[model samples]
Target: MTGPHPPRPGAGTPAGRPPVDGNAAAGLLGEVLAVEVTTAVAECRGCGAHAPLAQAVVEVDAAGALVRCRGCTRTLLTVLHVPGGVRLEVGCLAALTGAAPTGGAPGAGG
Candidate 1:
């Protein structure tokens, strides 16, 4: 679960026009991002300490992408990103964010 990202004030308020509620805490668009979690980032889910599980990798696609902790299997969000903006679906944060999956992998265009 994540906290609600409130929309900015006056985002849809226009002069001499009715304020649009579409930007009210939802229905907003922004740039995407990507992330690759190496196996060395294991941490304690209870104490947030790292010191367990040798190696495990997870690819995230957004600024706040969540993944299963290697030690406790708890959901952990990542803020890492690729060279360019993230372009993965926010729904499946655990999996790599990309256009689509081809041949059981990402970017393998068919």
Candidate 2:
């Protein structure tokens, strides 16, 4: 049951690269997402932790934005502005639940 464990939080990224909250990615994600994604709930496939996307860890730069799970720091989603449009990569995101509009039932998307 015991083995070499993965690096702790803040260990996955390059040195001196400080991780920020998911809110930092709101602007980048806003380009494609219609809903308020920061308020949405994201499920981590790696750790099975369900938390608000706002709580997730994010790293953004000229390339794009990387979203990681808050509980286990697992890669959840990545968005990159490509040549023609945008390239979105889903990693350890098991599910994403966002609030529905008024009079609409909440639904889940993955």
Candidate 3:
């Protein structure tokens, strides 16, 4: 007779629940993005696909988050939580718009 196999690593989830949507990144992104970036439209340079940032697929690890285009799966943004602040690296993101600017104007109060 055979025995039951052990659970696979990273299969499904720890609680055996389905994966969460991109909206789950809202809280983490809010503190760094400083705006409702999730709702903003993001254009992918790779495949010319346009969609709200919230619709992008996000993968998080010990380092930080990696946002990819849902259509072409090309990396769009990489966010690294550093010592004092967050480090953002942009990739195949052609444009990001429709999100209201936060704080003051650029180079206004120095």
Candidate 4:
């Protein structure tokens, strides 16, 4: 018997374009977290789903980037590049867990 079919390229995309992965947010997330963020675990506020930030669905363009939960299509984060610096919107993330940049507790002087 055949298994369930997978989603099409544009299955849940509003613009009918395939969504990118969270790796697309590397630069933005790196600046915000001061560390590699792809390995960080992000908890989605909408569906309470947890996954590495690298696994989140992402959409990027000239304006900036948007990260969403793969399970519920709920936006989890947004990053905007402005003249001064990058602006990060993360109200949709309930929590995030990861190793500190220096491999120590966050805020602990190395």
- Candidate No. with top TM-score: 4
lDDT of 1 by residue, 6-108 (tens): 6667654345344455454231121112122342234544446463223333454555355555555554454445577543333212332322112123221
- Model 1 misplaced stretches (Cα beyond 4 Å): 1-42, 45-54, 57-66, 78-84, 87-110
* lDDT (10s digit) by residue, model 3, range 1-110: 77866656777665676557768656544544565687778999999999999999999998999999999999999999999988989999988875445643332112
Whole-model Cα lDDT of every candidate shown, in order: 0.39, 0.79, 0.80, 0.81
Q: Global CA lDDT of candidate 3, please?
A: 0.80
TM-score of 4: 0.64
Backbone clashes in model 1, listed as residue pairs: 32-86, 33-86, 39-56, 88-97
**Which of the two candidates, 2 or 3, achieves a greater lDDT against the reference?**
3
Residue lDDT tens for model 2, 1-110: 98978658767345545556778666545433555588889999999999999999999998899999989988999999999888989999998877543324322111
TM-score of 1: 0.23
Number of the candidate with higher lDDT, 1 or 3:
3
Worst ten in a row by lDDT for model 1: 27-36
Cα deviation of 55 in candidate 3 (Å)? Answer: 0.5
Off by over 4 Å in 2: 1-33, 101-110
**TM-score of each prediction:** 0.23, 0.62, 0.60, 0.64
Order candidates by TM-score, high to low. 4, 2, 3, 1
| Weakest lDDT window of 10 consecutive positions for candidate 3 | 101-110
